[model samples]
Target: MTKYCRYHRNHGHTTEECKALEEKIEELVRAGHFRRFVRKDDNSFRSHHPPRSDHRCPPCDSRHGKRLNQPANHDPQPARTNVTPVDPPLRGIINTISGGFAGGGSTSSVRKRHLRHIQSINHITHSHHRRRMPPITFTDDDFQGLDHQQDDPMVITVEIENYAVKKVLIDQGSSVDILYWATYQKLQLSDTAMVPYNEPIYGFSGEKVSTCGYIDLHIIFRDGAQTKTIPIRFLIVDAPTSYNVLLGCPSLNTLGAVVSTPHLAMKFSSPSGDILTIYGNQRLARECYMASLHPQLPILQTNHIERPPSSEIT
Candidate 1:
C-alpha cells in the first residue's frame, strides 16, 4: 500500500518495507565493510566517519545489534572498605615496633627523616606561628623531692615508679580511677561502697552504659627492676570490657608519667629511679582522626568570632 523511494528502489520493495529489507542488505554489506579494513592490520578497523551527525554504519547502528545507552549502577559506601589491607613499609615499621620504637634499626628512616626535615623546615620558614618544643631530659634532682613509696606485692616495674598491675585497665584519659565490681570482688578491695556517676559512659562503639561504684586500690609498679606500690582512687564502670580499671589523665599526671607517640609506650618515673619512659600507641587515635576527616574537607579549623580576653599579665 506504499510507494518506493530511490534508496530502496533497487530492493524491489515499497518505502514501508524498505527499512527491514535495507537492514538485511546492509548487514551483508557490513561484513565486507569489516573485512576490508579489519584485515588491513591487526589492531582494529580504521574505518571512522566524518564529523556529520548521521555518522554510523547503517546496519551496525540499527536495533539488530545495537543496544540502548543504559547507565551503570554505582554502589554507595557506608564507611571505609572492610578489607584491612596490609600496611605499607611505613605502616609495617610502626606496627612491628613494640615496647618502644625510639628510632631506627629499621625503615629507610634516613631518607624519610630527610624528607620530613625538609618539610618541617619549609613549614617553619613559611609559617607565622611556628614553635618547636625541645626534647625532655630529666636530671636526678626534680623528682628526688617527692616522698618515697614502700614495697608492695602486686606492683610491676616499668621504670622509677612502681605501679600496681592488677587485672585492670590503665586508661590515661580518666580523672577518677575506675575499678570494676567483678575485679573488686576478685581482688577483695575494701569499701564495696557506692558512688555513682548519673551520666552514662560510652565505649569505642559509642553505646551508653551504666557505672556501678568506686573503690580505692593500691597500685604497684617497678623501675629497671625494683617494685613499689601507690594508693589510687578506683571508680567502678559497669561495661563488658576486660579493662577492669581505667586510669585517666589525672592518674597518669599524678604519677609523673608521660605518653608520647615516638616511644609508643607509657613512661613512668619510679620513686626508686630516674625519669623512666613508658611507651604507648596511637593507632586508635590515628584511625579515629582519619575517620573524622572527610577527604574533601580541609584539616585546619577557622574561627571568625571575636577573640577572648587575654589571660597573660601585662
Candidate 2:
C-alpha cells in the first residue's frame, strides 16, 4: 500500500517527505506563526525564541515580537483582545502598544514630553494676556491754560532721522503710524530700505488703501526739559494727504502718552519720573485742515461786462 501524505491529503508519499508540507512549514516559520502549528505531543519543540539584537523593539525590548505573549490556540480576531491593532504599513507596532495615538507618549518619558509641550503653549498665552501698562491717570494741571475754542486737529513738528518734519498729526483715533510717500521720499530712503508690509489701511470714508512698505526710524520728541527718542515703524503709503506723518495710538500707547484736544497738548511720564508735555502748533493744524478741504471745495468764477456791450447786442 502507498503511504499517505497527511498535509497534502495525497497517497503518493508520506507527510515527512512531502515537498508541499515542507514549504508550508517554512512559510509559517518566516511569518512568526510556527508556534501555532506545533503539536501537543511534541514536548521537545521550542515555540518562542529570543529575538536577535536587530529585531528587538526599538522603544522597549521586553519581548521578541510586537505581539503580546498569547496561548497557542488564541483567536486571531482583533476584538478578542484589548490590544490595539497597528497599521500594517507602519514600520513597527510599538505605536499601538505605547498608546501614542492619544496625543501623547506611550511611556512615562513620553507623557512628560507631552506635558512640557502643553505647558510651553500655556506660558506664551499667559504672557500675552497679562501684558498691561501701569495706571495712567491725568489731572487738570496736565492741560494748564492752553484750552481755547478751536476745532482743528492736533498737529506738531517732530524730529525724525535727525530732520525736523513739519505737519505731523497726533491722532488718537488712528491705530497705526503712517508716513506719506512724499515724506518718505523727502527722507531720501531707497526702495531697498523698506520692508514688505502685508496689511492694508482704511480711511474714515471706508476707502481701503494698500500700503507701499514700511520703514523703521528714530523719532525724537521734546517737551521743554524732557526729551524722548523712540524707534517708530511707519507704514508708507502713496496717498495725497495734508499731513506729512501721523502718530497713531500704537506710538502713544508705547510711550504711555495722553492727549488733550481742548488744550492742543499731549503729556506723558518720562523714564525719569518727570512729566513731559508737547503743545500742538495751532496755526499749522488750521493750515493743514484748510489744505485738506481745498480739493473738495467748488470754484466759481464771476465775469462783469461793460454796459456798452448790452447796447450793441440790442
Candidate 3:
C-alpha cells in the first residue's frame, strides 16, 4: 500500500508523519501562530503524558554526529527526577511537535538543531567526585634491582588469560600494542576469535607490517600482592620479533603506568590506591634486543624475577 502526504503532495509518508509539516507547525507555534492550541499551563499537558519515565536518549557520538544504538543489557544513566519545568516558549514548541519526535521518530538535521537548542537552554549537569590517584614519583631506590649500564628496553612478563606470558616489551613510544605470531600460536587462541584489522602498521624504516587481526585480552600487571588487570587490544602481526608481546602507550596510559628507562621499572597504581612498581628484567631486555638483531638465533627464555615488596626498597 502506498501512503501519500497531502502536506507535501507526494507519495511515501503520510501527511501526519510528514517531518516538514511538523517542523513548520513547530516554527508557527514558536512564532505565536498556534496560541489557542497551547494550554495556559504548560505543565498541564505534560502531567497527563509524563514523558515516559524510563525513556532516555542515547548518548550522541560526536565523531559520527549520530546516536549509537546501545545493547538491551547496557546500563543507562540515572533518570533525572528533579527536572525543571519547561519554559513557555519551549513548551509551546513541544506541544506542536508530533509524538514521533519524543519517540525518536523524526531525525532531520532541523530537528537535531532544535533539540540541541532546547538542551542547551534546559541542560542539567550533574557533578561527580573524581577519585584522585596517588602521585607516582620514581626515586633512586626504583633502580636498586637493575643494571643501568645497559641501554635495554623495558622488557617484562605479564599474565594473559592466567598464563605467564614472558618476553613482553613495554615500549612507551609505540602507539599500538602488538602480539607476535609465535606467542599467539603458543596461547592456543582460535583464529576465529580474532577481529579483522586491515590497516598496515609502519616500522622505523617505513616498512609496512601486515596485521592478521586484533584481539582484546586481559593482561595482568603484578607487583607482589598489588596487581592491576586491564584489557588490551593487541594487533596480531606475523613479524619476526624476539618479544612475545609489546605493551604500548594505549595500555600504559589506561593503566596509568609511568615508565622510567633509567630506573628500569614501570609503576602503576594498584586497586588498593597504593603504587605498585614492576621492575624490568634488565638481563632479559638485553637478550631480546640481541635476538632482534639475530633473527636466526633461538629466542632465549629466562626466569621472571618477581618484584620485591616496597618495604624492602631502600
Candidate 4:
C-alpha cells in the first residue's frame, strides 16, 4: 500500500518527501514565517529536501527566493531634470558699464548715455555745494530805545493759552522751553492735560532734574504793530525758580529772533517785512534777580558770621 502525504494529500509520498510541502516551506521563508517551522533543539528549520535553484521572488522576479535579495520596490536614484542657471539684468548692465570704461567694443551711443548720467549726478552735487544762505545784518534803528545801563536779562510778558503770563525769560542758551510747575498750576490746567516727558534737564549749577511732564500752549508774542502766534511745548518741572516760564532757543529760532544782551531786546524779521522788537522788563528783571539771591544770601550770612559780633559790641 502507498502512503499519502498529510499536508499535500497526495498518494505515493510522505509529508517530508512531498515537493508541494517543500515549495510551501520556501514560500513561508520568503514571507518571514520560517520561525514557525524551526525546531526547538537546533533553533532552525531542518528540511530533508534541497532548496530550489530556479525559484523566483514574488516581489522582484529574481532567481533568489529570499525577500532580502529581491530588488527594492522604488527606484534608488532620482530622475534627472533639465535646469539652467540665469544671470540678472542688473549684472549685464554693470558689465556693460565696466566694459565701456575699460575701452572695450562698447557702442558710442551707450558710452554717451553713461557719460550723460554721470554728468547729471555731478551737476546735482555741484548745485548742492553752491547753495548758500544770505548773511544776517542789523542797522542802527534796531537799537533805538535800548539802554545798556539797565543791564537786565531778556525778560518779557507773553500771552499763553489766553492767559497773560509774566516773568517769561528769553534764554538763548537753553535748547527747550520750560514752564515752572508753580506757574503751570496757576494756569488752572487739568492734570490730564499734561503729556509724559522722560528727558532730564540740567541747570547752571550742574544739577539734573527729571521733568514732570509737558503741555502744548498757544503763545502770543507782541511787538507794537507786529504779533506772532506760535505753539510752544513747555516741559514742567517742580523746582523753585525766579522766572515763571523760560523761552529757549527752539521758540527763538522758530520766530527767527535775534537776542542782544547789551541792548536788552529781542529782534526778529516779521512776515510783513518789518523788524519787530521786544524789550526786556528792567524792573522785573531786577526783582527776580534779588529774589533768586535771597535764599543763598541767608545761607552765606549764617556760614560767615560768628559770635565775635557780641564781643565787639561789649
lDDT of each: 0.40, 0.64, 0.68, 0.63
Residue 251, candidate 3: Cα error in Å is 0.4
For model 3, which pairs clash? none
Model 3 stretches with alpha carbons more than 4 Å out: 1-132, 302-314
lDDT of 2 by residue, 1-314 (tens): 45565764544345555544554445555454555677657654433333224343223236765433232453223122233344568664321111111325225677688778778867567766655554555566655444366776888777776566777888876767888887887766798999887556666655577888888888878776567888787888887777889888767877778888777778777778777788788777776777777846531210111112213221
- Candidate 4 stretches greater than 4 Å from native: 1-147, 296-314
Sort every candidate by lDDT, greatest first. 3, 2, 4, 1
lDDT over C-alpha atoms for residue 207 of model 3: 60
Q: Work out the TM-score per prediction.
A: 0.34, 0.50, 0.54, 0.50
TM-score pick, better of 1 and 3: 3
Could you tell me which 10 consecutive residues in candidate 4 have the lowest summed lDDT? 93-102
lDDT of 4 by residue, 1-314 (tens): 45556774444345555556675565555445555666556434546465534443224335755544223453223223333334446633211101111221136776577667657866667765554433345556556444656667888888765566677888877756888887887777888999877656666655577788889888878886578888777778887777788888777877778788766777776666676778787767776778778855432111111112223211
Lowest-scoring 10 consecutive residues by lDDT in candidate 2? Answer: 301-310
lDDT of 3 by residue, 154-223 (tens): 8888887656777788876676788877788777789898988766666655566778888989988888
Q: How close is candidate 4 to the true structure, as a TM-score?
A: 0.50
- Cα-lDDT of candidate 3: 0.68
Candidate 2: give the clashing pairs.
Answer: none
Residue 225 CA error for candidate 4 (Å)? Answer: 3.6
How are the candidates ranked when ordered by TM-score, highest leading?
A: 3, 2, 4, 1
**Where does the lowest 10-residue lDDT sum fall in candidate 3?**
93-102
